[model samples]
Structures are given as structure tokens and as C-alpha cells.
Target: MAVPVVTGRHARLVRVTHALTTLCFLALVITGAEIIISHPRFYWGEVGNVNTPSLFDIPIPASRPWVNTGYGFVMPDQNGWSRSLHFQMAWLLVFTAFIYGTWGLRTGHFQRIASYYNTAQRRTYLLVIFALMPFMIWTGLAMSPAIVGTFPFLVTLLGGHQSARTLHFFTTLALLLFIAGHVVMVIRTGFRSNVRAITVGGDTQA
Candidate 1:
């Protein structure tokens, strides 16, 4: 006799994972906005200065009175707190994504993947959105010259840092759109069933 699986916990995890992803996305948007505004002209490879000046041309005199001279906002320096927050949140996102993806795979989420490929799934849009994320993460990490510089081809693949930055922006937009759609769907398609599936790890009446 086979043992019965406790799906409630899984359902809860799913719900939590979605909530977390949504939160992380907002954080990413804010941090990314800071970076872009500060350094509109992005560089690729080791060609240009990555540590450009920030948009806030004002000085925080109150924060650091000990400094002798006035200072203009610098991208690398100004975003220390923002960058740290972004990195910390990104780590959470990456870790949570792994958990969610693993759960999906183990629980025959691949069936959904397959259905999308075969054009049998109801919401094929989700399949496309799902496919984009890993690629975004891969390119995002690859373009980071400071971290994981193992692959030389990455430079060419991304057409240097500038191109990577562009792609990252587009990907971010895509993620935002996906989130918007996801929220709309969750609300439109009877939130109760989704809530139950997510909270209790059990299928509801379809």
C-alpha cells in the first residue's frame, strides 16, 4: 500500500512562495530604478566606468559632517544601502525560486510545461513567462563582471555590459507584466480555489 501524501504543507509553501516573489519583484524595481537613474550610460565588459555618478547631485551633509569637502552623489557609493538591500532581496528571491521550481518539478509541474509546449494548456502565457526567468537570471549573473566571470563568451553573448543592462531592463518589465497578469488571474479565476490549492496543497473542484 502506498503512503498518503500530506499536500497541505505544500499548498501553504506555494502561497508563501508567490507572496515572496511578488515582494522581491517590487524591491528589485526600486533598486533597479535607483541604479538606472544614477547611471543612465551603462558600460559593458571592462570598457567604461561602472561606478558612475548618481542622479542625486545633492550632498548629505547631515549624514557625514566629518568629511572635509562637499561631494556629488556617485552611483557606486550612493547605492551602497540600496545595493545591499537589492542583493539581500535577490538572494532571497533566487533561493525561494529554487524551492518553488523544485516543488513544481516534483509535483508534475513539468506536465504543465509539456502542455504548454504542446499548446494544450489553458494559459500558455505563463509558460512563456516561466521560460524567460531562468534566462534572465543566467544573463543577469553572467553580465556581472564582479561576480562569476568564468564564461568569457558572456561578454559576446550579451554584447558587452551595456547590452546586458538593456536586456535586464526589458526582462524586469516582462516580470512586472507577468506579475500583473498573475494578480489579475488570481482574482478573476476564483481566488478561493487558488487559495485552497496554495494553502492546503490539495486540488479543488475544477
Candidate 2:
């Protein structure tokens, strides 16, 4: 009997991981937005506050009463719930990433990189996978008191806690742009087929 060959679809683990990651990321984006609105200022160095000079402002009213956004009234503070949800989703994303990474490494799945991505997609994605994502994760961890307390070097390397926070915001923006471009590419290539491939997959010969 001839062994069946799977074609067109990504690995089952990859597809499942991709789906989970997407959901987690979408949730994170929503929660992150709310968190930012609580204080839309970016800062630098180890310490910063409303009193200190902000590196930049988002040009929108803050959601917190203490932020002093120069608006007539403060928006309701969704920070508590949003931050809690954001942390939960971020950890879930990290878990998925760990599984996907380990599986890929163990199976040498990354050896098939060229087959899964085009030249442009490969380049852009490799940058995200290897560089930007790591940077974002590092900065995020650096900003956490618990994380910094244990791994002081993480914060030191980044120069300060506030620096990490500022950098994380920019990293999020870069990821958003990448996500938008990825969506556009999928639509241009064939939205339905692409979705099918990522989910149930495309045609396969057995």
C-alpha cells in the first residue's frame, strides 16, 4: 500500500497554532488599545510620569481621571479589565509560540520555509519572527515589576523600564502594519483560498 501524501495544507500543529495566535492577538489588540487610552503618553529612560516630559502623546483624550488630558471630561477607565485581559491573552500567545517553536525545531519544519512563503513574505515574516517579536517580548517583560525584580538585566539592557514601555508601543504599531499588509496580500492572492488553506486547507491528493 502506498503511503498517503498530504499536500497544500500547512502542518496540523501550525494551522491550530496559527488560529489560536490570531485570536489571542486580536484580543490583545483590543485590550491594548484600552490600556493605551488610559494613558496615551510615551516616555523614555527608567522613569516617567504625567509630571515628567512625555516623549510623545497620542493626541487623544485619556481614559483615566489622573492623566489630565486637557479635555472637558475623562473617559471611563477600562484599564483594570483591559490590562487583566491583555496579560491573560499575552500569556496565551506566548504559550502558543513556545509550542509552535518547539515543534518546528524538533521536526526541522523551518527547513521547509521556502515552500511555505514567497520571497517577500519570507523576508518580512522572518524579520518579525526573529527580530521584532523577540524585541517586543523582551521589552514587555522588562516593564513588568515582577519580571524586572527577578531579571534585572532585562531592564538594564533596555536602559530603563520607561524605555521598554515606549518601545513596546512602537513595536505594536509595527506588528499592526505587518498584519494589515498580510491581510491585503491574502485578499489579493485569493482570500477564500488563502483562508481555506490556513484553516481546513486546500486540495490534497491521497
Candidate 3:
């Protein structure tokens, strides 16, 4: 049987959404790493007393002489602009995810992506998406004292900010893994075909 192809306006929209999301994720990864390492300490294990630099080597912005980023019980100082950037990136991510998720549901992106897969494949796809993505965003937010403080119940649910930080790290790791798997799947599904679909509406224009 001939293989099905992605074509037309919908495919173009999907491609654009994918591109934007990819960029957002990459930016967040870099900024998030810098934010996490600003203190040179971690909630999990001994991150050690090492001085870790920002991921992009970009200097933290100048912001009010740098205050301590209050992570519940732990407060780290001289984080420079890492805090601001982190919060900015967090907002951007949340917005991007909201738009992408809404579009996905409205456009049937999820269904179309999984329609070709078997039950097992579909399960993995949904799990990575529904379970992992939401968890990452949630845990990331929970790390903020302001957020946790506002919703005291979050501290209980997350077992404190320290625990939230730990969960955030793992969630980021999971996102990375999901991105890798997604890229691989895209390639396997026919890179050229997919690219065309995304760029020019399937291969119709090709």
C-alpha cells in the first residue's frame, strides 16, 4: 500500500508550531541551566561547592545588585540576573505551551501524530506528552518560593521546595529525552516527507 502523506494548510501550521516549540524548549534549557547552577548547589545529592557558569556563558543581567533566590529553606545569593532570566523564560514557556497545547487539541495534532502508531506507541507518545510535559512545567513552577508560598498546599504536595527542585531537574531530563525520541521518530517517519509537509504542506509543493 502507498504511504499516507501530510499535506495542505494544516501540515504547514503543524510545522510552524513545532518549530516555535523547539526554539522555546532550547532557550529554556539554556536559561534554566544557568538559573539552576547560579547557586552552585542542588537539592539532589552533592552538587558540590563548585562554581558552575551559565550554560551559554552569557553574563547574568544587571538587576538591582542581585538578591538571593529564595528556594524555601535555602537561599543563594549573587545569582546575578539568572533569576530574572529564569522567570522570564518560565513565563515564555508557559505561554508557548498553552498556545501549542490549545492548538494541538483544536487541530487534532495529537490524534494525527498517533493515528499511525500502535497501542504501545500511542501510549508512549501520550505518556511523554501528558505526563512528562505537565510534570516539568508544574515542578518548575513549584521551585519558585513565590509560587509555593502563594499555594502553601504545593509545598505539602511537593514535600517542600527542595523536593520541588529535585523534581524539576528530573522533569527537565525527561523533556530532553522526549525531545530526542521525538526527533528520532520524525526522521524514521521520513524526514524529507515530514519537512515538506511542514514547510510546503506535505510534498504537494515538491
The positional error of residue 112 in candidate 2, measured at the CA in angstroms, is 1.2
Can you write out model 2's per-residue Cα lDDT over 1-206, one digit (the tens) per residue? 12223555667787899999899989988988899998889898998889999999988898877888788578778889998998898899889989987887677566556456678887887788778878878988998999899999999988799999988889999999999998998788778887887888674221
lDDT of each: 0.61, 0.83, 0.62
Task: Please tell me which model should have the higher lDDT, number 1 or number 3.
Answer: 3
Most accurate candidate by lDDT:
2
- Give per-residue lDDT, candidate 2, residue 193: 83
Please give the lDDT score at residue 85 for candidate 2.
Answer: 93
RMSD of 1: 7.0
lDDT of 2 at 4: 28
Runs in model 2 lying further than 4 Å from the true structure: 1-7, 204-206
- lDDT tens string, model 3, 1-206? 12234533345445666676667778778767666555434553212222432222223332222423333333334345656766676677677678777877876777765875678778877887788878877777776678877887765687767666777777788878777886787688777776666666645222
TM-scores of the candidates are: 0.65, 0.90, 0.67
lDDT of 1 by residue, 1-206 (tens): 12234432334656788779768878878887665555454444434442443222223332222322254433343456767777788898889889977777677654544553335334445453376676677667766776546776765676766567666777877777776776676678667886677665566433
Where in model 1 is the C-alpha error above 4 Å?
A: 1-10, 41-78, 112-130, 191-206
